[model samples]
Target: MTKNRHFEIFLATSPGLEDMLCAEVKLKGFRQPKAVPGGVTLRGGWPEVWRANLWIRGASRVLARIGQFRAEYLNQLEVRAKEVSWGELLRTDVPFRVEVSCSTSRIYHSGAAAERIAKAITETLGVPRSETADIIVRARIENNFCTLSLDTSGDLLHRRGHKEAVNRAPMRETMASLFLRKCGYNGQEPVLDPMCGSGTFVIEAAEVAARLNPGRSRHFAFEHFATFDPEAWEQMRAVKSQRAPEFHFYGSDRDAGAITMSRANAERAGVTAYTTFNQATVSDILPPAGPPGLVILNAPYGTRIGDKKKLSALYRALGQRMLEHFKGWRVGIITTETSLAHATGLPFLPTGAPIPHGGLKVFLFQTDILK
Candidate 1:
């Protein structure tokens, strides 16, 4: 059993994606991480923090819970903030930034409260505060209680620090993982996306199948803290190669440009060696030589283009293709319109939740049997 620690860590994700993120955390071997409103809360120590930064594909960011206190007013907030031992978490040479959010408490102005907390850090620990610091600690208050957290993962962990070439309407990493989870993808079998724009589905599926660390290539803010252990981080990174699988991940896009983008994105993700990218339309979709598994697609949902009628034919054709060719394979489609999904013609059950994708509401449609 991994030794338990007094600390709590949170892995934040976009709203409505919490369940998927929490499931991914558990699948990656973290102990009981509870799904919260915007994130998952896990009980662990610094080693877990390092592991979370190196792994945890679905998290938008990882935060370490440093302190929690009740403050009905600014005077109480300042006094409480000053009492905490900021020196233990910060150093004079290292600069930091603070973000604040408040709800249902006397501390109404989050901006002013954040300023006060930043001032407290500078006054109490002598650490300079700056907007562009490598470290950004956040304080959130609700019902007159404040919880302070340090962002362990920098750059909004969803950035993955990869995907230099992404097309418009590219899916966020957090959303991709959540969608994969909802589609029942476990990285244990073959997965493909015929409309793999930016390779979000394909890349995330490959990452899971190859057992690659999603955050491995990125830098985290926790590294700057004085308490961050280099040895622990190294140990976490050393497991990268041990997790790779022995199979190829497949993805194809109708757009030649999207195919190129997926290949480039997969290359940067270090999973290209295990990925196969092709250029083909849904009509050209074919079964892989391997056993059938999950098939997920995020096609043009007629969202930004403002032409549902034009895309209706496209969606209808896609449904016909899936029904005719993809028998016995689990199929998942994400789209913004119920009528567009109906156009697919394949019998599907609504996943019953709205997920935020590309600033539009997307619902997942799944069909277990092509017939």
Candidate 2:
């Protein structure tokens, strides 16, 4: 167990966007943030953890590493787990769940390892265990070393407690923010998503430009922790750095239902004043009345059999429209197939590393300002 309040906090993000996430963490003034394989790691206490959850747009979840020990067997694990100061972190009245993973360890049975630790918590802290509990205790037993962490964010950070309505295959807000960073957006320029499904890109851009906190509307599991300070958290949340954006973000889709969903989502996210949604197809999309900016979209790529040919034609049409109409504007197109991206014939720079999204490998194809 940690003798002091400070602990290592891990901000989990999608695999391929670690660099962008690290950039955001650095820009946000996080202390000594280091990019790892799956996410970024920083050293801080509870307050830093809370702020990361509230402000970091690219993180999918926040984890607090509480304690660790070496245990070669289940008996040793149970004994060592009981020795940790559970009362310092967990409340007896609250229910929690334990999830464990084991690899290359003598105590290789993850189920048994989880059971031993859960038993220790139940016996030592008098807390009840439930599979559906919101408070999570995660344990990993790898190479004879055991590490324990607490899931501070109750739900995924992408939920954001807003955006109730969504379209099919909607882009997550976390992914959208990272992609925007990848496109070199810094809240000063305008953004447009021509095939906006549920208005994710536009709403995210508006939120970034307005300097809104993503977790302002939501509750976290850490609120129930014994170490949580409600007063300090309230003060942190009360401080707003909101700024007026100079330009508006826009989204348009061929489906009227998608436009309706996007409008509702934007309103719920409190970006309606800075965002606009329209019902229009890709061929009909026109540049908004402003200085040239970014045109980013997550177009549909046929995942099923025989869907690629039709999507190819759609891509060609999209490319032709942008080539003819949108001069001096950059484009970021996300798709699963390079052939579909090739159909656009946009002067795309080198394709980025493939990002795993919705069980398919997707890559970002970007271009300089179109001539």
- Evaluated with TM-score, which candidate comes out highest? 2
Q: Candidate 2 on 1-371: residue-level lDDT in tens?
A: 33256888999988899999999999999988999988999999888989999999999999999888999989999999998889999989899999999999999888888899999999999999999999999998989999899999989999999889988887889999999999989898999999998999999999999999999889999999988889999999999999989999999999899999999989899999999999998889999998989999998988832388888888999999999999999999988889999999999999878998888888999999999
Model 1 stretches with alpha carbons more than 4 Å out: 1-5, 241-247
lDDT of 1 by residue, 1-371 (tens): 12244588998887888888888889878999999998899998878888887888888888988889999988788888887778777768988998999999999999889988888888998998889887887999999999999887878877888878887777787788788888887878778888888898889888888777787777778788877777877766876454666566778877899889999999898888878889998888887887677788776767755489999888888888777777777888888888888898878875676876667888888888565
lDDT of 1 at 256: 90
- Pairs of residues clashing in candidate 2: none
Residue 348's lDDT in candidate 2: 96
Q: Give lDDT: candidate 1, residue 331.
A: 87
Per-model TM values vs. the true structure: 0.94, 0.97
Worst lDDT window (10 residues) for model 1? 1-10
Query: Any runs in candidate 2 off by more than 4 Å, and if so which?
Result: 1-4, 304-306
Q: What RMSD value applies to candidate 2?
A: 1.5
Residue 324 alpha-carbon offset, candidate 1, angstroms = 0.6
